[model samples]
Target chain A: MINLKHTKMKNELIKPQGLVKNANRRQFLRMGTMTVAGAGLLLIGCNNDDDMVPAMPGMVSLGTGDIGILNYAYALEQLEAAFYAEVIKGSYFANASAEEKTIMGDLEKHERAHREFFKAALGTNAIGALEVDFSSIDFSSRTSVLGAAKTFEDLGVAAYNGAGQFLESADLLLIAGKIVSVEARHAAAIRDLINPGSADFAGDDIIDSNGLERTLNFTQVLTAASTYVKTEIDFSQLPS
Target chain B: MNLIKLLDTICPDTKSAEDRDRFYSRRDAFRQFGDFGKKVALAAVPLSILNSIPHVAKADTASLIGVLNYALTLEHLEYRYYQMGLDSGVIEAPDRVIFQKIRDHELAHVRFLQEVIGNVLNGTPVAEPGFDFTAGGNFTPFSDYPTFLALSQAFEDTGVRAYKGQAANVKESDVVLTAALSIHSVEARHASMVRRLRTKKGLDTVKGWITNGSIGSLPAATTAIYAGEENLSHGGVNVANLTGIDAAAVSEGWDEPLDMNQVLGIASLFLAN
Candidate 1:
């Protein structure tokens, strides 16, 4: 019922074939073969591509289980990190105040770190690089840029709030909690920047009268992401 | 003979033989009889009847994870809404910085959930598409600053309520739950900002804090505001369930859970047909 088969397929795609079976034996042999000659040879053979080779494609697919949910968060991080990177690379707003520039720069750095953190944790299982289409944005204008920024910040907070329940691993959930809290802080900061005294930016839109948050399935989110993303995402494994 | 009758006819004989045979002698007979019994049982069932039953789809876990997905969808919609506003040349220069930061944060949130999904499932699911926040051009168009501010206020307010409604689903996971609550607060902050912006511009938007009278019912003055509004619905979903939450308590410190149906309906406002 949980679509174990779909999860299994995702697992098979993420992990290199035979890694599980030969892990122990390979470790033993590697330890024994860690000689000075081997070390020198390895150093000489190491290539930059090995470190920077983009993670395998589709490794971020969160199969229908809980881990699938975490991957969803990771993929978003990839997009944010990339967006900030581009923003920093091209400071589009000519009139951007020094303070605004600094804050934006700091945010970019933070997003990058968050992205790398997820990538490291996910290893070869991380998702492929995503292509974001921001053509609709007029980066040259402060108004257009900030408008998009507000949307991103507010949406980030809401998304995290809605998806927090699916985490099964306490450790992973703890890390997510830490990261999302920071994102919330960022959201508040953005809100205030847009309008002073708007520190309490959230309202009935995000939370209901019952004091509870909303939950969404993968289908709902993918529908929204389809606009900016060029690559086709296969969420078929997600629980319907 | 019908399958039931044939089984009934054969069953008695088998039972009689089984009862009459002595213990040692009846062992082989019993084995044969047992095999026959199994065959009869299978033969008596109709394959066509079994095939006719529809296979039910398994229910997904409506836990914190489900709730987060719901939030993620909302965030995506908001992100797009603001993007459209900024891109369409409707916002003023002063407001541009404000919306930019908000957009950045929304993207961060989208990324955050993507991370969560990846971490939880160890892979990224395909992102969904086809969201139309304008609702097929039915609601107040966000063509100008006033309309944009008002619409943004509605979107932000809805986001707050939606987050409050789904809090319980994630309570089981303390870490995720706490993070979600924190995000909920941030969404609240965004809503308040939008409301203040609207109020400043002479729009009679509700205050940041909901009053007792605001609970359980739409204010008489604003009823017409959303009536027959197409933007209120998301993918054929309705917002009726959203009224179930105690709006008075919304101003209180505690986070309120939104009705799933209501959240889905609000989400539909941005859903692409």
Candidate 2:
């Protein structure tokens, strides 16, 4: 197995850090732009023609139609991959039980695979690598790490579920189906690690009385993920 | 004009009782076209008749209903397995809650699919077929805890793949597609928990996500469940060597889909003929 610690250090050196360094200042600017963009969207909604607006700088559009949904999934996978990469390097995981270590380690790889799959499949059309800000998570504590993992995994499942209907391509939809279940498996494992043998694995919070998991719209999911991601996502083409 | 001959023409793989039941349903569907029904011999009804008839809308509806019925069939099998296992007293505490929760979810899935078929879609829901968890007396899941866990893993994993295979079939209906996706993830969660339980009980090779189709100590019957799961390619991309992680982890990262025929073949094992 590749040493995760060595890889983390290598990532820190080679991966782009310039964007993350200015995340705080850029986030403020992005928030202002988003408010204006939100108003602009409302006005555009009043019009019948749903033509694509030309690309805007300092902002990333998820694209239009099936490509839009694929980019949306790509964005989420990037966030998840980044989060797990950090989790494996944390002190808590470094000293965890064999079972916990195995779960966390495998999670990182699975998420990375998902991330790379989308990137490769999307090719030129794929969205750029996202910049995630997970400073809120305390990696030194097991509860904190697992709690955040639970949140990401649940959100990922819901996002994929909601986005499936938007994808016009059956092939792309099948690809999404392949990844979403793995995300759910990751979610359940993390939940069990927190409360072993408990009903929390498929807790009522996420699963409804009808035995279905929750589905979240693009807007809902993006809003929740905004706290962790520094990159401003413009999903105007994606339906709410 | 025998129904058996007509069914053979329609579905060549009608070798099981469940397959026969599917054909019987199709027979009823054909009878609904009253004008065409009276003129044509049942065996002479060509598959292309659907294109000639002005039933395109109805045809689409039938296909969607067909997909949902397939899903409900699997859910029925899982619900019965867990329900019987719980009643048999093979599942004890700690583990008991896991199976109980899984049982309730499967039941909910059954009810939800039934309501959608009957009320929302205005189609007849498929009836729950009889199940023999013993798989023709090959093993006793209800009496043996390890056997129960093994079967649970296989069923949950199969449920995940089965729903995935049908996603494209239901893609035309946004509501149905979304509902199916929601259920798909829950099945994965169940599969993961079951696998974890197996690991905790000394099946050390088992992991939440399948690794290289490794069945660990599970019976050979379940080898089919993990078949094709070792696939390392996705969307034309070879992912095995893409990530720095081991190839096994890469395979574990993505769950593969099993098409309708393959899923039915596996489900047929438990179907009470």
Inter-residue clash pairs, candidate 2 = none
Cα misplacement distance, residue A101 of candidate 2 (Å)? 1.1
How big is the positional error of residue A199 in model 2, measured in Å on the Cα after superposition?
0.7
Which tens-of-lDDT digit does each residue in B1-273 have in candidate 2? 122222222321335666556445655665564345432432244444322222212565678778989998999999999899989999876688988999999998998787656543446789999998889999899888888888899999999999999999877767677878989999999999999888889855698898888877888888888898889977666787666667899888888999999999999999998
Model 1 lDDT tens row, A1-240: 222222212124233443444345434544554312111111122222211212224323443344345457766676666666666656564468764675566566556555555554544444567667777667776666766676665556556655665555444544454455446545555655665643234433553322333444454455555555555444434433
| Alpha-carbon lDDT, every model | 0.49, 0.77
Model 1: how far is A133 from its true place, Å? Answer: 1.3
Residue-level lDDT of model 2, residues A1-240, one tens digit each, is 111111111124123444454335445555544322211111112221232333345456676676667778889989998998998888999999988998888888888888887776665566677778899999999999999999999999999988888877787788889889999998999899889889899999998877889888776788788888877676655653
- Each candidate's number of clashing pairs is 147, 0
Over all chains combined, what TM-score does candidate 2 have? 0.79
